[model samples]
Target: MTATTDESAFAAENAFGKGEPNIAYAQYFTGDSFLNNLVTDPECVVGVHNVTFAPGCRNNWHVHHATSGGGQVLICTAGSGWYQEEGKDAVSLTPGVVVFTRAGVKHWHGAKADSWFSHIALGVPGENTSNEWLEPVDDAHYAAL
Candidate 1:
């Protein structure tokens, strides 16, 4: 399933509060990770989640899609991490960095081998929004990063 962390670790490393970690749904991720629902506004078409990844924790390749227009944005709020799209070089993540994975792009994001990481995940709302989860990021691929 999911992993738990000592709250102090995040408190010292992150700019934002590392709210209680939610059991990262098994259907979506690989290794250990947690989620904090920071904001959910259905009316304004916006939602934000704080996600924490212990060292080496990551999710599988996935896609966010919408019939009209929508995708996902990640605002790095703490520590170090990695983000990669299918067939592209992995980008390093740190505080103040923002990543925009447009709808229909296959990608994955997670912590580095020796560092914990957190990001504020923003959901860009659109009609017919949905997520497509695919295979895990292989160990070999990650090890090289």
Candidate 2:
């Protein structure tokens, strides 16, 4: 279903629960998104967070750069979405779907035009790991999906 402005409705629909507004990275997104941290202890090996996207919302193309073993893992939790790597076809996202994005792989993901979406993101541990946010996904390209 499409996104709703009603905070209660969104909370009831999202399983993992929504956190605060994603104001810190708003510039990288096309629409509203929320971030809820599942793991925040510094001792934790992997950084885990639950991300909820409003309908038609998506992040810009980005990469996780690492000199060693570094990458990202996305566990789809609710509604529908799309994920695409550079030069590759987009992958459909639904509950239980999992995506493994290796370091340096240019890619982008977001909710489908008519659906709200949520996913749990895991940051793989690695040496010299850094994130590079790039250009937003083109409007025409997203519309064609």
Candidate 3:
């Protein structure tokens, strides 16, 4: 389904709330997604956000690079999804599930074909942290799921 800011049943069930369109990173995603900033205070060391993904929507393969200790933590809050790393098996995501991706790990995550997915993403603090977006997951690769 097309992604929009309209309140969906998934959004109503999600406690964190469905946010606005994720325009800044739209090019990196296969379908529609939303981003809600949970921590907007500049003084906050950790960056926290609630990401809502439409059915069949997923981001491209990417990496979070850092010189020291940067990484990402995803806490599934609503619906179901899948998280996979390069050369590894894809993990199923459900509410209460948590996944930690270390710095420089090539990975991708998104909603399943028939379900919406929401996760709270925590940016781990580190030095010289940057994100590198890579190629899309591709239809064949995603269909295999």
TM-score of each: 0.87, 0.92, 0.94
Give one digit per residue, the lDDT tens place, for model 1 in 50-127.
888878889999999898778999999887889999989999998888999899999999988877789999889888
- Against the true structure, what is every candidate's RMSD? 4.1, 2.1, 3.4
For candidate 3, the TM-score is 0.94
| lDDT value, candidate 3, whole model | 0.91
Clash tally for model 2: 0
Worst 10 residues of 3 by lDDT: 1-10
Candidate 3 collision pairs: none
Instruction: Show where candidate 3 strays beyond 4 Å.
Output: 1-7
What C-alpha lDDT, on a 0 to 100 scale, does residue 20 get in candidate 1?
A: 62
Model 2 over residues 1-145: C-alpha lDDT tens digits? 3444454665676788877888998999999999999988988999999998988999999999999999999999877899999999999998889999999999999998877788999999999999999999999999999
Candidate 3, residue 46: how far the Cα is off, in Å: 1.0
In candidate 2, what residue range of length 10 has the lowest lDDT sum?
1-10
Model 1 alpha-carbon miss at residue 45, Å: 2.1
